[model samples]
Target: MHKNLSRWREGEQAGRRYAFTAPSPTRYPWQWYWDSCFIAIVRSRWDRERARRELESLLAVAEDGFIGHIAFWGRPLDLERAVRYNVVRRRDLTTRTIQPPLLAYAWRIAVGDPAAEPGIAAHHRWLGGHRDLDGDGLLWLLQPDESGLDASPKFDHVWGPRAQGRRRFPLLIRRNRALGFDLRRVADAGGPVVCEVLTNVAWSLSRQACGEPSTTPALVARLWDERTGRFVDEARGAVHRPLPPERVPFTWDTLAPLALPDLPEEIGRRLVEETLLSERFWPGVPLPSVALDDPAHTSRDHYWGLRRYWRGPSWANAAWLAWQGVRRLGYRAEADDMARRLGETVVREGLREYYEARTGAGMGARDFGWTALALEMLSPRAGSGSGSA
Candidate 1:
């Protein structure tokens, strides 16, 4: 625990432009939207002021309630030259698309309920106005990065080479405009138009926490696959179709709706009994990003040889969210056991970006922020509340 705390303190960065926690100093050197939220939630356990500042720095740069997925700290020209996707590049050293809306949940946890109100309202308004691309009451995820599950198989068909081109780029821009954005969208759109489960669940959890009406019903109607008894990624265009069990495997992201405390009993039961506790996801470590039986599962090697960035890696943040859901649904022993195993793995392997599902081998960036943050979740002082779904 002392080692983890020391690593976290070392990752803290304060600059003229931003004061926040970077997920990893060597790997991720910028302020990421959802990462900061998780960091702040954990930081609240020991340092309230730093926790508040972690979120406030991100909110300080929000435009019309849309916080960039990542805020770069250096000069604009240097960033502009390096960033290939125009959609993510901004004049003020930030990305354009927002990450999962976990800020509201984080703010309520780190700051007080009253202090979180304005940002919550503004962010909710912005999402409703600019992200509900098809007027389906649920928001659309433009890219896999926006959903925070970058290389999941759910988006495999959507982001393939065939989806890229000049024609699709303009349609994407038009779609953004129709959805209420004033700026021009510059990236080519070939990725699937998904009403991502995590994004919607996060939004719903945040709304409910803020005393706003829940959007779970709308989300269920859009993504719930009655045939599979799970939430599958629903594509907007006819470019994709539902796959058979042998070909397309269920991923942890599909079960993200379980994180919602108010999830319907029947749906939640199916998730816990039929999936999470089953051999599919509960193999050994608890919650892997991809199920072991899934055809797309890859336990060795990281994405692009950099690090295991979410593909078949077990993440503490995701596991902690699942633990909260399990505890909320009365699986006290199961949740506690899972939490204990996670803490043990982190302690043994040291703080890392993620871990190998079965072996618990530490992977990715070392001295990671969220890896250290997981210790706080395991501590007795941690509150029983929903974090990033």
Candidate 2:
């Protein structure tokens, strides 16, 4: 396992060095905040000075308190023309869309210290600027598709215009009609349900920003499904269940009350334990966006970039996030067990963007975000009890 891990880490470092040169000597490609955050997390384990530079670099790219989404080599991707769909344009500069407010949490984990006063204050101010608290107080996400890499079909609906200029990938679905693999026909397929990790993260951040009492009524209402005793994807409305059932068990959903200091403890605990760990939800792969039980699990036969579909694959980021929340609530034994399981699986199967839920087989970009996440978790410098961040 150690040998495999070392080889994988070398591959990841090489990929990063080659694929990601600072777009410019001075500027950054779109603000790539979450990506930068993750890079910093891993880099901190290797080189604290460079990790610090990565954060400072992100700050360098911020404009009007928000990070732009697309930065070319090091400069911002040029958005000189009106954004168009299916048309090749000049420089693509549509960076307003945001991912999760994971920078602060990830920074705390990576830096291994409480953020300084200015650093903490700056992040909070930026969070406030980005948060949309209308009269009703519901935190409306202007562009929900900013949670990079969930690979949902419905993203075109919510973020069509902003996402237009970006490269688009074909979504292929295959169904076994009790005959064989038929790529032509797929049943019960529609646009993807909302699977935004950042929106959920925003809910978590809001609680942290507000002193960790209770989730605001608006955020709670967005996620609440009184009938199921669980949070559903907000964009899908009440009709659609949250895809990736395994993640639903993640303490993020339960931590909502703790973060906001709202909701009944019993309700949160029940949802955390029963539904999240239920056989129907927990896939053999362990980290699926859509659980093993979902009908759509096998429908998407291929992945973006001609790669295989990881939409249903178990992912390290989701697992690490779950580990953090679980341990925070003092579920130490459970945390250790989960970390060992997820880490061992990634090490054994080889790191891919995701893993097959039923088979534990790995697939997707070889050294992608999920794979890098696993490496970061295994890095000894990631800190004790810091299963994954």
Candidate 3:
């Protein structure tokens, strides 16, 4: 246990120590949501006190429970200034719109650690309720970026008015299609407007909070089209009138199956297999993102340049979701393998805000939530041995 504790300690300290970075060539950094989740998970194993501290540190700095996406050496970052760089916040402009909800998930895992219980409960209570943007009982994505398919053309119509005209990169039309990103509307040549990912994940959390069978299944099933291999927006339908077959499926599209609790075994297998074949889904790399594969898949530099925010890239957050689906289907080895690769990539790449889909390289802000989650997964203490799924 001590050796495991040591490993946990090392992992937690690594996050705490590396948590801050220079905002740019000169500014300092602070703990982000992704980093906190990683730090909290690791801390829960060896030192519950540290886990609570991690959340406390965040709360002390947080304004109204909505933590900022980035900070400079413990000071909140001024993201508005970074808009020129295409760094987006949730609609609120306070935090990065789309972080993996691993914090809630992690808290659930660590609740047994008495020191962690209060903090975990507090955070959960903060996130437990619903925000009915569409008035559909399902939560709405506060920001398009929260969907992790940022600036993808699919939102040109869906979210254009609300996002204030943030559209997909012009170059993504060809590359996204080529990479197999076509199946998902988020990669539409036009840009996706509405975000379903955040809303769905929120529903999942809501179910967890209420301690009831998931209602997401009914919502997901409503979106599923027998005609198409992917799910469609219940409100807008497909972005393209005669939607391209390849454009309909994205990594989030695959999540529909996992969210649904009791589908026929064959039906579940088919969705997974389809996702595997979708070139845009795997992108020739182990990492999974909103886009599967497209010719103009985001390159690390392209993303940093805001040329292809969500057109294509292996996002750690999406990888976490994909891993969940893989595990649900008894693909434990594959899931763990992915967790290791993603975690190693974050450390090796010295990650920035995001990454390039064409190549598994980091881009955007350094040590952003996606990459940070990857690091936490690599922690020896962060497995089923420590808690439940």
Candidate 3's displacement at residue 166, Å, is 3.9
The model with the greatest lDDT is: 1
Give me the runs in candidate 1 sitting further than 4 Å from their true place. Answer: 2-17, 74-81, 84-91, 114-116, 162-191, 238-247, 303-308, 380-389
- Least lDDT summed over 10 consecutive residues: which range in candidate 2? 170-179
* Candidates by lDDT, descending order: 1, 3, 2
Candidate 2, residues 246-270: lDDT per residue as tens digits?
Answer: 3342322332332222334565456
Error of 2 at 264 (Å): 6.1
lDDT of 2 at 47: 63
Candidate 1 TM-score, C-alpha based: 0.84
Could you tally the backbone clashes for each prediction? 1, 25, 39
Lowest-sum lDDT 10-residue window in model 1: 181-190
Off by over 4 Å in 3: 1-31, 42-47, 56-102, 111-130, 133-136, 161-195, 209-213, 232-253, 256-267, 290-292, 300-308, 336-355, 365-389
**Root-mean-square deviation of candidate 2:** 10.4
lDDT of 1 at 127: 87
Best by TM-score: 1
lDDT per residue, candidate 3, 113-210, as tens digits?
32234443444343334233344444434334444455644444444333322333323323333433322333233343343644465445434533
